[model samples]
Target: MKRLLLVALLLFKWMTYAQTNLIKNGGFEAELSYWRGNDIATISPYDKKTGKNGCTINQYVGEQWKGIDQIIPLPKNTIALELSGWVKSDGVEKGKNEWNTGKFDIEFLSSGEKGIQNESIAAVVGTTPWTFYQKRVYVPDGASKLRIMLALGQTNGTLFFDDIKAIPITQEQLNKFQEEENTKRMAAIEPSKESKVTLFTNGDFENGNTAWRGNASTSNTVTKEGKAALMIQSSTFDWNGIDQIADVPEKATTITISGWLKSEKIQQGKDTWNNGLLNVAFAGNDNQKTGDDQNISFVTGTTDWTFYTKTFPLPSGTKKYRIMVALGFATGTLYADAINVTFN
Candidate 1:
């Protein structure tokens, strides 16, 4: 009986080893021996969550774009692949490119031709604690190689990566994992009906741009009534804006939108193309333009904190409305606070 049990244990070990980890030196245990990139190096800073050494890009001063990547040949009969790792950051910010947020990317090549590409499931930003990120992709026919990349583009910060792994997985397993994740996320954000009634969830900016979407950021430089406010700074005639969508209360007839805005060195360029202005607009559920578009043009020059209000009748068939505040096509800084939308 003892010899039979020993044989079974040996077979189980072989089976586990057969499920290979395609990535080499994934933990940076060998200290950058297998990774390649400019300004990429292995760091001795052990991750608290994983308790392992991590790889970092541009750990020292002198902010510049940097990345690390590894290319591995794919084995035969592979169906799908999953890449996962832990990432920690400090003071990471977005760059000129919309996808500039520090992230990991995976690319598959077939006969030296690109086939599949994807980035981390979510953007890594601000001072984040050690968090796990993952991406999964189907292996296309004739795929020959896979490239794994960790990148930071035009952003200032320190990013540490650890315990990276790439392995083959079944499509059913990937779908099960994604469904579990979505269910967890939905449960976490489930709020009471009273909380859902408000149109703008983070209008006060107290939650630090939680529901607002835009190229802007949250800052403590100026606040009408909170610890933080939305700040938008532009160096060119680019329209930087923030917006949110709120559900229209049933039987609502009118909606009123109000907010406080301030600007600094706002310039109205030589032509309409360069004009800078603060604009607020409301759109219907189908994203069609509504009659609620309002603007306070920076053509009037710099302005102190001012209150703006606009009321409009809810258009027929409008199930929800989107509110957008933007610093339109100019160079300047704009601060906004206490945005509120109400229904009668």
Candidate 2:
């Protein structure tokens, strides 16, 4: 009983430590002043020069060290190192080739590279309070030093940074992240239990339903006149009262997004778009709008009704997303059902 109690206490302490040990726990580690080109200080170092209001070592401009500027001691069985940070820009915003872009890059090396720096490019920071940002980086088996940089790009902007922590995540943490991701995906595609699908436009009937309209701009008025049965065909053009969002739960391992899609008639004409083959992309749109039928389109099948499904590993940082369905110059009909999201 005593041994059990002690073990439980140790586990509790470990959990507590993991929950609060993100980078930037104790403020800035060091500060660098571009005034003196060769001035270098320790991580989270003290700074006499301040920017904005009254800058201190904790809030100085130029490249600064986040957290304890201590080189992370390489672990024995470590696979990768994920570096993350947040920045608020405050510089003369300029365009490309303007020498005022708020550009910044994070560099990593086995040893602090004086010139040959391995840089990871990122967007420029603008006028905003310190916001949270993160990125997962894969480190080679034999890596040692890591450094983050902030410089003036074509859009130089005053940048403030905070909260930078680096720790080796265990396999357990990875699994938890995956599980959280799957949970978010499931949340996005929940069945509306009360999906009140109103008949907008039926090709079979001449003027029974109005043309597909509303938030999801759809048009189901075109039809092919048949002798016996009038064929109905229309794709769900847009989402109805749906927001473009991505969610992930805690402790997620593997995320699988699946749905039942059925379609009849394959547009196989010489003048068809992309040879009558529809495409479904994760993040792409020609009009640059969410759920646009023109982007991320899918193909239709000919013959009898058939179901199609696909599954893939979820990207580490990707949690939730919106879905878009589209139909091009095709004949016949199409229907989607049982759109389900699951985590295993």
Candidate 1 clash total? 0
Number of the predicted model whose lDDT against the real structure is largest: 1
Q: Model 1 misses residue 189 by how many Å? A: 31
Model 1 global lDDT (CA atoms, 0 to 1): 0.65
Highest-scoring model, TM-score:
1
What is the TM-score of each predicted model, taking all chains together?
0.43, 0.36
Residue-level lDDT tens digits of model 2 in 1-344 = 64356435433543443443323222343333321221322332222122322121122343333221333344443333444455555543545453344433544556544333454433454455544444444444345555554444423235444444454544454444423432343343433223332121232223322231112122233323321112235332111111122233434544444433344664432123312222222221121222312222254565332334554444444333343333332344544333334455
Worst 10 residues of 2 by lDDT: 236-245
Query: CA RMSD for every model?
Result: 16.0, 17.2
Error of 2 at 59 (Å): 16
Candidate 1's residue-wise lDDT over 174-276, tens digit each?
3343334223322333333554554568888999978975557877968888798888877543345666666778898987878887878877543342344
Task: Record all residue pairs in model 1 with backbone atoms less than 3 Å apart, i.e. clashing.
Answer: none
